[model samples]
Target: MLIQILLILGFVLVFAITWRRFGQNVITFREASLWSFLWLSGVAFTLYPGLTERLASFFGVGRGVDLILYLAVAIQFFLIFKLFILNEQSERKITNLVEREALSHLNEDEPASANRPSNYESNG
Candidate 1:
């Protein structure tokens, strides 16, 4: 059907983007592989939606759509959690670097300032 064809195309597009990201070093090999697998799985499920129904039934869910929605939400939450952790780590690193550089600059300027006459001292 037209819908299946469109779904397949969309999945292919996702796979292409994942591959491009991996090639460009924007994502690691493990990340690309996981995403590629997910896209391929999407294509497979779209091609045979009955599988989702069967899985849903096996898991005691009333409908395949519901199961998919639940899974998508859970995945979204996990990804958000991971991004939060990474963001926190990045902020800590930036703060530490800024503090270290400030201390180093202060240390380098101390001896020079010690030998320099202050404007008030010079005027007096």
Candidate 2:
């Protein structure tokens, strides 16, 4: 009973954070919805752990704990992959911005002297 209560409280906290993130536009509506669904599913599983056993059996897993562990590992890998993709996208955006800025400066009406090597570069 105590465990169930704690689980519910944890779900409530997650729900609150999800709502706040959505309200602040930190995440899209679709992401908020997905998070809410996941939290509710967690609450369901906590309230009825037997359901996991049944699910595990259906999936040919030996135990509920094993199934959960597998899921957690898969989720971790997926998140890591997503983070890698996002990092790549960010790098591309930054590179494009730098290139654009450099091109714009080249097109500006600067004197030839402005294009001279920097003092440090000349010294080197």
Candidate 3:
């Protein structure tokens, strides 16, 4: 009964994530990695009941492994959010660097081009 509920929720989460990740350019490998992880984790959580005993003993959880899994999922979500923030920050820095480089080259050329060789001259 309880397991069935968990299974349903797990499938729902996977479906939602799949739909969301569709038709988008994953600019960063982090996005791709996270998507894969979520889908895989959703499957694991859905199938957790069967491995409850094994995981329970492995983790030394007396009640069961469900709570541990729930905690793990929550932590994973937190980590994903952090990864997203870090990725955004990195992209912003890259954009700024590119813009600065473009401007620097433009400024350097205004005064330097007049004295530079006109590569367009023919050897005729």
Instruction: Please give each candidate's TM-score.
Output: 0.78, 0.76, 0.40
Candidate 2 per-residue C-alpha lDDT over 1-124 given as tens digits, one digit per residue, 9 for 90 to 100: 9989998999989999999999999999999999899899889899899999999999999998799899989989999999999999999999888877775675366687777433332121
lDDT of 1 at 50: 92
lDDT of 3 by residue, 1-124 (tens): 7876777677667656655565355335576566667566556655665565666767777645665667689888999999999999999999888877775575356674366544443232
The TM-score that candidate 3 achieves is 0.40
Q: Of models 1 and 3, which has the larger lDDT? A: 1
Each candidate: what lDDT?
Answer: 0.87, 0.88, 0.67
Off by over 4 Å in 1: 105-124
Q: Candidate 1 vs candidate 2: which has greater TM-score?
A: 1
Error of 2 at 77 (Å): 1.1
Tally clashing residue pairs in candidate 3.
0
Count of residue pairs whose backbone atoms collide, per candidate: 0, 0, 0
The residue pairs that clash in candidate 1, if any, are: none
